[model samples]
Target chain A: MPSDSSPPNRRGLITLAWLWVAAPLAYGVYELVHKATQLFTG
Target chain B: MSSPPVAPAGWSRWLVPPAALSVHLSIGQAYAWSVFKPPLEAALHLDGTQSALPFQLAIVMLGLSAAFGGTLVERNGPRWAMTVALVCFCAGFLLSALGAGTRQYWLIVLGYGFVGGIGLGIGYISPVSTLIKWFPDRPGMATGIAIMGFGGGALIASPWSAQMLASFGGDNDGIALAFLVHGLSYAVFMTLGVLLVRVPRTGDGGGTASGPSGPSDLEGVQVSARGAVRTPQFWCLWIVLCMNVTAGIGILEKAAPMITDFFADSSAPVSASAAAGFVALLSAANMAGRIGWSSTSDLIGRKNIYRLYLGVGALMYLLIALFGDASKPLFVLCALVILSFYGGGFATVPAYLKDLFGTYQVGAIHGRLLTAWSTAGVLGPLIVNWIADRQKEAGKHGSSLYGLSFGIMIGLLVVGFVANELVRPVHARHHVPAPREAADAQRQQPA
Candidate 1:
């Protein structure tokens, strides 16, 4: 019966969900950026 | 099991993307399989072609299985599909670990290619429709968020995997251990998706999905998967996807070699390190395009965006062919744009399907359309590889090696551009009856 309302604990879970996926994605991006910088370096 | 539990009232729609990402990011490791090839070839004493067999077969199985398992996903739900994908994919890795440890190359092929490929297929399409349902307000962005993970998967897997190989040593035991680690770690990561995912609650849940804001340019009608293939719109989109993918993937598959060849005879020959950088850069562009251009499609319309991908994309190919070596910066810019279009072409198609067919069975329909990708996977590389091999035989080097291939890709783009032009809304005869009408008719008949 509620619509789009998140309890504090549920909000924490949502944050974790996003972070769970985002952290790996960010790590991948970091590695890619490190490699990609070499194109101009040479 | 029956379908996974639907979301309770007030359950956040946002949870769905991570679930999709969990599956996609894991399966996306297929892109990084090249990292395993040299090690596998060295340890197993196989040729380059022989080593590539598992990745190639995995792609083939991805297409076939996705096309086949789509309806099952709609039947069993995302949690079930994710779990199955986790099992099959991880099991494939475990089997490959066993194979590598034992020096049985065939087992690696069976494990990684056949078993894991099914996981790739099923896992890939599992969350697509759910995302569409959740964010009908922005279906393009919804799908893009998850599908982009498939492109980005390699970025994460490639470096971590290389480090693992570097640390563990690239011997048979090392490779087996790496595969074991991947299987176990991915099992844990993907399980999060299975647990987090929930279908949207239907009917008197007090909260409705509410937003169905697909493109208004079309008739905006519903068509089941069966009726979808029967329409000309499907085949036209299929051809459009095929040609677009072939052109893009052709370059992607041969990227490092192609860039090196393009500049080999020139004064500014690309170094090996720079070439690796170029490949990494392309991966970035590819990953960015999935989220960026697909989200743009939500605003600009799918047909209009395909116009950009195919139309501008052909011009970029022509530029690369004629003047690629003239400037390194220019060449990189053109190639980057082309790769982005390639990635964009992939991410945009699901929304395009929703536009043409509506979301009735869009996942199944998308699965069927992926056969184009499977076809392109073979055709794209074949066209480039065959031509390059012939050129090598003739002692052709540098940009000349790819001139003919580029020309052929331009023609493919033209064919795709024409196919995009041919797309129109589905005809009224092909429509599934509106639910209210079907329900009304059923009531009259039963009495």
Candidate 2:
């Protein structure tokens, strides 16, 4: 297998990936909250 | 065999699951199709069934494209597969917007169903084998995270789409705008997966042990997708998946209405809004089950976990059939457990495939297995809806309408349980031989 010669910081990349996952999930939560407000308050 | 590109230094295997989640979450929006149904029917002057064609065809295409494109995905690696998924998925939305703007239902079906569905299948599988390679120690948990995103996609999309429709008006123009936004936003969202994905440097040829967690016993044989189909183990699993999905989907496809019907005669009948709440709860159970139960599988063993899913799932159905209307709490508890099993079944199967077939072409094998899902997608709903319709015609009401369907589901789960019991490790004849050392050395050298 071709190995990476210049591997960057592993922790940074993993953190960045977690941010990507969190972005949508946060948006999803936001939407859910918005819907709940509409259902209860509107 | 040529080796896959090694991850550059600092590439934590942990980064891969999030990459997989990005793609799976975006494609999981397919589950929110119900939110679009009423609006599409009203705007297009179509019936409920007509409006459902896009969702139905998308599922069929998801299975077919996954099966046919599985090898392409495996050969090219996840980056290539995710790129194809991003393009097809986004483009399908763009085209659907055009179709809606022009009031052409066929175009909606063609774009969303055929094109987007291909994206769904490819996107769904793109991350599976990669995650397994990255987290060989916890295959079930790794896949569960990504597949859990798929189960939760609807939770995000349903309300978002509903709000968009509310704001934009439920006309063709509004629908087009929504489609356009969905296409563009998801393109940007799924790009994260395409950019972040990497195949393990160890390569997928079943040579190097993925991690310390990988099962030594499973190191025995690696079956090609072609060879796998010829084995009894594959067909047995196919039946197992189909029956499990069929049983869950039968109830899920009609959750809101079925619940209301079950309690129509109660002192405080289930209202439409309340029924919608019930659907949302089921979605939560479904999402939770994917991660929770699949993670549980890693500790208990895949075969054992399935015994619970298939066995307990049947018992849950029987509970509902016998005493569903007598108490609301009992009915809700049984339904929730059943939905969880449905989600668990989906989340755990890739790892199960890894167990039986090895990681060599497990993605492709998984894609082939999804054909069972497409089959169940049709079969489950058909059995429930057809039977319910007949019961109504025969003057049956309330829980009686679904009694036969629930009994049938129990029977199906029992069959699936038996099939799960029959699974064993693949034979050595099906294993792919390890790559020659000379070939590996040559590939490692500069061209």
For residues B1-447, write the lDDT of model 2, one tens digit per residue.
Answer: 223334554466666788888898899999888888998999999998899898888888899989998887777778888898999999999999999999998999999999999999899888887787777778899899999999878877887889889998889999999999999999988888887777654443222433211222234567788889988899999999999999999989999899999999998677776676677677778888999999999999999998999999999999999999998889989998999999999999999998898877888999999999989988999999999999999999999999999989999999999999999888888887644542454457578
Error of 2 at B100 (Å): 2.1
Best by DockQ: 1
Q: In candidate 2, which residue pairs clash?
A: A2-B6, A7-B8, A7-B9, A8-B9, A10-B10
**TM-score of structure candidate 2:** 0.90
| Residue runs of model 2 more than 4 Å from their true location after superposition | A1-8, A27-42, B1-5, B203-218, B437-447
Put down candidate 1 lDDT per residue, B380-419, tens digits, no spaces. Answer: 9999999999998999888888999999999999999999
Write down the TM-score of every candidate.
0.93, 0.90
TM-score of chain A for the candidates in order shown? 0.74, 0.62
Q: Estimate the lDDT of model 1.
A: 0.86
Off by over 4 Å in 1: A1-9, B203-220, B434-447
**Per-prediction DockQ:** 0.55, 0.26
Candidate 2 at residue B289, lDDT? 93
Q: What's the CA error at residue B171 for candidate 2, in Å?
A: 2.6
